[model samples]
Target chain A: MRETLRYVASRLATTFLIVLGAMILLFALSALVPGDPATALLGPAATPEYVQRFIQEMGLDQPWYRRLFSFMGNVFVGNLGTDVLSGQPVTRIIANVLPYTFILTFSSIGLAVAFGVPLGCYAATHRGSLLDHLLAFVSVAFIAIPSFVIAIFLLLIFAIWLDWLPVMGAGEAGNWFDQAQRLILPTIALSVGWIGFIARLVRSSMLETMGENFIRLSRAYGLSNRLITYKYALKNACIPTLAVLGMGVGRLLGGAVLVEIVFSRPGLGRLMFDAISTRNFPVLQGTVLVVVLIFVLTNLLVDLSYAAIDPRIRRQGSR
Target chain B: MNPDLPMITIRNLKLDARTEHGPAHILRGIDLEFGRGRIVGVVGESGSGKSTLVSCLLRLLPSNIERLEGEILFDGIDLLKLSPSDMNDWRGRKIAMVFQDPMTALNPLFTINTHLRDVLKRRFPQISAREARERSLAMLTKVGISDASVRLDAYPHQLSGGMRQRIVIAMALLVEPDLLLADEPTTALDATVEAQIVDLFDQLRQDFSGSIVFISHHLGLVAELCDDLCVMYGGTIVETGPVAEVLARPRHPYTRALLDCEIEDDHGGRLATIPGEVPSATWAMDACIFASRCAHVADICRRGPTVLETVAIGHKAACKRSREVLP
Candidate 1:
């Protein structure tokens, strides 16, 4: 138990450093955008005096380092400033849409794992068969196609052509059935490529694990093929898959940006898109920071899970 | 299950492995028998099909096997004729195996407890978890593992190589298999550990009445532990006899060469090595497989296939010149 505690503590320290670095980098990159926030918000028709007053009011008139320090200071105190266009605190805007993004990301990943792991395992065990080849071909095709392209195609076929689902937007809040119905197309669009990616990963890893001496021993012991493949082989094979899945979370989040825009859904991706166009640096910085934190935390969880799955790693951590 | 009958009999067994060049004949017309309660040692260098023979016993041949024709009659029933599911039932319950590298034998992701308990549960489906644990703990203690209860909870990675090997032996023995196939069980261990494991096998002989087929490259180990010995060369048994008789008077040139290769502390000269490489497994032999490397190679050896000829009571050699070659 103490070893676990030390392991988690060390991982948390690393996560903190990663999030801080991402925050600093996000601030610097946003500052480098070639547009003045005041000008973008006020428009060309606005008088120079109004623009000057707006700049001073929002503290854009301060030097870059001071702005960065104040931004960091405000973030540390749980304040993300106001959106210039909406006139709402950036934190409130983020909090409102965070649930939608979380639903999309988690549900899509859950779907990917549900289908990918089994398909990959089947393909590996039946290697060189026609079905295995077909799965291989289909997975490669899906992986080669970008998620946005898939989203557009799915949107066209399901919403526009078939008229089977909503054309846009996350469904009405508090209505579980309608919300799930709307989530179908976007989730499918987002998860298809990931399913292919994960399947390919699991296929290769399972193949390698099956070739291990212990797996052969399991077979020699007369364990059923299903038990050996799913339980014995998959447990060891899933280690690499877990690490990849952690990184997949970040990729899926980035993919959600385009999917949300294409679907016109209310999410951090859509918020960031609007903020980028309006030069709303505070909202953009806040959203990016949250995404970075989620990515780092998921990866930390993945690392800790390695200890849970493999005793060799657990012993190493204790040492 | 007549107690007077031999435990297992293998007849005219042949196996071919698919290689890039074509099919490689891995095992060529093997004939052997194991009397009840006897320990047989099969010794050969790498590529001599010693390991393949054991895999054949379990029907665990690799995917590249092109053909396998044989009768593996375990107590009058042919193992090769059984369906896969039936074979599975026969595998752990009737015949268990111990592999060469214990370091790689047990799954690293599982605790020794899980490894032991799972095997018992699989063999005896109605066995309670508590009973399985107790049986496993008893087997561990029987295998000379101290603090067996505590060791059960430890993962395989936490144990030393010798300890893991003992656990593997414990697992095999716990099933009370009628036949135990051990493929170089101590080849991966240090000299001291190897001796200890050998002694453990000696101790197991007292309780384990089942037949054992021990495969190894170490001639000394086989001479010390086995009641019968089979000398293999070029994927075929070159000689077989009572261990004492074979070691005392090897009837085949290859067997003589092998015994010479064993290192002795009093030897002052260079280490003895058999001349020539093992014949390529891909070759289709119509003559003596060892003709190219045998010191006593003659025109007759290259002219026709060699078959085992009786040298004495319970002794045989594949070489036609067995009587002249005997030292």
Candidate 2:
């Protein structure tokens, strides 16, 4: 128990440092972009006097180091800066769109695991079958194609041709049924490649696990093939897959950016897209920081779960 | 349940594995029997197919098996004729196995409690979880494990190699199998632990009325623990007899050479080793398999296969010059 606590404490410390580093890096990169925030917020036609006052009020006139220090101070207290274009607090804007992005990312990953693990296990168990070969080919095709291309294809088919779902937007604000309807296309578009990737990963892992001595021993003991595969082999096989799934969250979030744009859904991706075009530095910074935080926390959870799944890891350093 | 009948009878068992370079003949025409309540030891060097014979008995041969022709008669039933599901039913319930490396044999993720419970449940599908746990605890204690209750909750990794092996023995015994195949069960343990395990088997012999086929490369262990001994060379049994008689007066050149290879504690010179490499399995079985390594190799040994000829009652050797080569 003490060992686990120590491990978690060390991991949390590292996560904090990583998030801090991302914050500094995001600030530096945003500052380097060749655009004046003051002029971008006010129209280019605004007078020089008005622009000067806007810059002063926003502390844009301060040196980069001082501005970064103030930004860090505000972020520590949950105060993401105000949006230069809309004058809304960056935190509130981010809060509104975060749920949509979370749903998209989580559901996509859930779908990937739900379908991929079983399919991969079936492929491995029935290794040389025609179905295995077909799944292999289809998975490779899905993995090779970009998510945006898949998103556009899905939009073209589901929205333009089939007319089974909505064409765009996050649906009506109050109706969850409409919101879920809008989610299907974007979720599938973002998840298809990951499903393929996870299936391939789990296939190889399960194949290797099946070859382990314990698995053979299980067979020698007369355990059914189904029981042995799922109970004995799959548990060990999933350890590696779990690690990849944790890292996959970040990649899925990135794909959601394109999927959100193609679907015209109001999410972090859409918000960040609009922010970039309008040179809204605060909103972009806030979105990236939130994404980084979620990534780090997801990895932390994966690490903790490793201990739960494999007792060897759980007992490490205790004896 | 006949007292006079042998537990298992293997007749002309031949197995070949498909390889990139055609078939590798693993077990060539093995004929043997395990008497009820007797412990039979099979000793051989690497690639001698001692381990493969165990897999064949379990009907758990790998997918690459190209040819498996034989009759494995368990009691009066022909195991070879049974369906796969029937074989599964026989396994654990009738025949169980102890593996070479206890470290890898038991699933690392499972607790000892789980491993034992699973085996019991599979053998008796209607068994309750509580009943399984009670049986597991009793079996662990019977195998000489201390604090059996606490050890039940411990995972395989939490125990020593010897302890893990004890648990494996417990699992095999939990089903009260009629025949147990132990393939080099002590090769992975240290000497002290090996002695303990051998002693455990010795103790088990008194109560475990079933038959045991113990496979190992340790001649000393075989001599000490086995009632019957079979010396294998290149996938064929070269010699078989009462362990004392075989060790005392080995009738085959290969058996003589194997007995000679055993190092004495008081020896001062370099250790003795069999001169030639083990014969490749791909070679056609047209002659004596051990001819290359047999110091008394004659022209006739290379001409045709030699079948086991009786030297004494219950004693046989697969060498043409068994009488001439008697030491």
Top lDDT hit:
1
> What is the TM-score (0 to 1) of candidate 2?
0.96
Put down candidate 1 lDDT per residue, A141-225, tens digits, no spaces: 9988888899999999999899998858888979888999899988998888889888889999999998998988877788889
DockQ of 2: 0.78
For model 1, residues B88-186, the per-residue Cα lDDT tens digits are 888888889999999999999998888887788888999999999999999999999999998999988789999999999999998899899999999
Estimate every model's Cα lDDT from 0 to 1.
0.89, 0.88
The C-alpha stretches of model 2 lying farther than 4 A from their native spots are A31-48, A63-65, A317-319, B265-269
Native contact share for candidate 2: 0.69
Each prediction's TM-score versus the true structure: 0.96, 0.96
Model 1 chain B: weakest 10-residue lDDT segment is B263-272
Provide the lowest-lDDT 10-residue window in model 2 chain B. B263-272
Candidate 2 residue pairs in clash (backbone atoms < 3 Å): none
